[model samples]
Target: MKRSKPRLAVFKFASCDGCQLTLLDCEDELLAVAGQVDIAYFPEASRAMAPGPYDLALVEGSITTPHDAERILQVRRRARVLVTIGACATAGGIQALRNFADVAEYARAVYPRPEYLETLAWSTPVSSHVPVDLELRGCPIDKGQLLEVISAYLAGRRPNLRRTSVCTECKARGTTCLLVAGGVPCLGPVTQAGCGALCPSYDRGCYGCFGPAESPNPPALAGRLAELGRGPDEVERLFRTFNAWAEAFRGGGRPA
Candidate 1:
């Protein structure tokens, strides 16, 4: 008898859909992945939907509405392993800036009739709504690392996701430190390793798209920024970018 292929499902909530696109962007490896697993559901890739008690579910996006709150519970029930992909699902993404501001005012600014829109006051990460098996952090996750995660799940092994800072990648590539050499404000000291230091290689500081590194010393980094003549507000603004809702980036006080 032949063994059944593992069923895979991909889900989305409130997001830009960039992370889901990363899987599709994996043009070379996607066909190979399809052969290894049953692509039972992936709305971004196909309209053909499959009901699930899925072996794995890759969720991309944050929860930003009452309907999504209820819907995610159902997803959790149907999925054996729920892995949140991208900053939106893992750290609440840029939309989470609403959490610090007045949602009512925001709605009025964006829409002519705010009453017609149904939304929560704040955007929150997937873990806030359901128990997550894993979280893959990034603005748009690295395709190579994403493939490794899928491969690891299929083999029943832990995905070797790095918890280091982007500074490590910068050093490995022999890229000059933007902060030290060019006097650019960089989150590379605290941002997670991914993107292969793309911004720094192009002579720009890292923008913390991968979220905070493990136990990042953001305060020390803030002090360094001050030495570089960045004001307190500028330092706060830097931390409040892609992963503003992440605990490490948010710090002890309220998010800026």
Candidate 2:
């Protein structure tokens, strides 16, 4: 008897749809990927749809509404293996900054009838509501990493994801330490490695796009940034970017 192809579904919530685009961006390898799995339901790419329960589900974005909060539970039940992709799905994305302030007030300023909007008090990741099999971090996840994750799950093995800080990637790429040499306030010391130290190579600081690295020392990094002339508020803002709501960054990146 031949083994059947695994059914894969992609879901979205409150996001810019950039993570989904990363899947489409895997143009060259996509056909081969499709050959391995049944692309069951991906509204971003195909008009066709399939009813779950799916073997694998890739969720993108955060829960920012009552509907989304409820929908994620449904998604969880249907997926045998659920992987959250991008900062929005893993750490609530940049929109999570609203968690600090009044979302209703911001909604009122932006929308004509804020009362018409059925939104939650804060944006939250999928893991906040349901159990996730894995999480892929990044503002928009790296395509290579994404492929690796899928392949690993299908092979019943752990995804080979790095847990090291961005500083390690900089060193490997032969990129100079921006903070040490240029007195630049960088989050690389605490930020996860991905994007292959892209910003640091261009003489820019890591903006913490991939969220917190393993056991990150955000406070120590903040202290160093302060020594480099960055004010406490500036240091706080750096930690409150794409992965602001991540536990490692949630305390405002300051010394506790």
Model 1 misses residue 226 by how many Å?
1.1
lDDT of 1 by residue, 131-242 (tens): 9999998989999989999999988999998889999999999999999988899999988997899899999999898998986888888888888898888888988888
Model 2 regions more than 4 Å off? none
TM-score of each: 0.96, 0.97
What lDDT tens digits, residue by residue, belong to model 2 across residues 7-67? 9999999899999899999999999899999999999999989999999999999999999
The TM-score of candidate 2 is 0.97
Which one wins on TM-score? Answer: 2
* Model 2 lowest lDDT segment of ten: 247-256
Global lDDT of each model?
Answer: 0.92, 0.91
